[model samples]
Target: MAIVLGLRVLGIDFDDEERIERIESAFPAVSFVRLNGWTIAELHLECFPEKAFHEATDLIHQLGAYGELEFVEVVPHLVNTSDIAKLTGVTRQAVNKWVTHPDLGFPAETDFVGGGHARQKIWSLYTVNEWLSEVMGIDLGLELPPMNLVKQVDGYLALEGDPLLDGAKDFHASGL
Candidate 1:
């Protein structure tokens, strides 16, 4: 099954409007969203779990052709209690009770945001899905790449800065 994956790419220059249009036209399957200004972007696309690393690498290379590719990593899907409820087709009360009851063995929240009444707990969608499948015997039909694989791919990509930098240097040297 093809699963949706978000590739977080940094240091891509999208100053050329024509280049942006060409990229979009060429890779219609990938949707790019600028997260913080023009340099950082999240590319959303669907691919089989086993092919995530290859797919991400190909994307980084393709985008590198347009501009510098500084970094690339798989962005995990995050969700709150309400999001969990919606994803699992359960009520908010049920999710709340599960979190409060340790015996249920719900995954711990990855982080907390805000404070007091506005506070919200965040959990990795991957962990939540795993818990739902193992403990609750529910399969939401969502296939996420394993965290270990994600980390491995991320580490390998991080270490590949030299090649990407070399490509950027060549691009600038050509005076195009």
Candidate 2:
């Protein structure tokens, strides 16, 4: 099974599997608190129980009354339209419009001068990476450009599909 742990948030994301050898390799007596939605069924939790051997039938109801001790998974933030687009070799117009849309995701930020002209638009790097991995199937890494530097262009920067746009359009909409 695949387990994604959030060290900072004290949470874990787990996928069911036949057996978790990694946990046994590290923790001999590790306990899996089976949580299906809000209810916790203590009966379903066996000490290092074989993944396939564990009873998954009615897991939510079988958990019984251990709601207070369950380890819940926290949701991670997502990368901005432009950042995700740049990382995925796509355009901001596509990222902002065709991809994440208005009600989802966030914007990028940099520590350089003249940044954050607005405050509510900043994004955490991990959140952005998490979103990319979940939505655009792009892995977030630290290999992005340092910011404030984009592809150079010439003449009036129209909002249409100019094909000559530097790169900021990755943040803005296309055909604006």
Candidate 3:
């Protein structure tokens, strides 16, 4: 179990089904939400979350329940621009500019972790994979090019190593 913090902080359990069962049985009057969808973004729920929902990401650590359900508290996933640089093998400044996509005149799809002065975009590890598959045509193993890695030299998105993490980043930063 971990404590989720945001507008409100709450304790979440993800070790096993015991916590889920306990919450469900005890809070029969409360709303219950199911983990569903290719990305499992928690579209439906029995009740509104007091804070951000916690997501136990499947980052190749477990294969059996890679897409299975686990209880998570709601919270924004913290990420640094450098992490984006590693995923795309580019300089942090270039990655930050890429996130903005000002030259392309396109907006990223995302919800800022903190609104107003503290606002910053929330990037999902899962969305990065989908963009490569659907837009870049990468494979399930996260292998091969176009999706794996892209290098922008002379202002062109070039093909690089296997889209190790799918040569892509989901958000081009903006107020959103």
TM-scores, each model vs. reference: 0.69, 0.25, 0.30
Order of models, best lDDT first:
1, 2, 3
Q: Residues 1-176, candidate 1: write the lDDT tens digits.
A: 54345566665455766755666787765556665353344444465666665665667677776655555566756889998899888999999998889799889899998899999999998888889899998899875666755665565555566565555533432323
Lowest summed lDDT over 10 consecutive residues: which window, candidate 3? 148-157
Off by over 4 Å in 3: 1-70, 73-80, 103-109, 114-118, 132-176
- The lDDT, on a scale of 0 to 1, for candidate 3 is 0.34
lDDT of model number 2:
0.35
Sort order, TM-score high to low: 1, 3, 2
At residue 159, candidate 2 shows an lDDT of 21
TM-score, structure 3 vs. true: 0.30
Give residue 49's lDDT in candidate 2 (0 to 100): 23
**Which candidate wins on TM-score?**
1
Model 1 root mean square deviation, Cα atoms? 7.3
Clashes of each: 0, 10, 15
Q: Over the stretch 1-176, how does candidate 3's per-residue lDDT look in tens digits?
A: 22212111123323336654564454332223333211212222222232112111221112113323332323223344565566656688875675676663323545556678977665654455555356545444532222111111101111111245233312111101
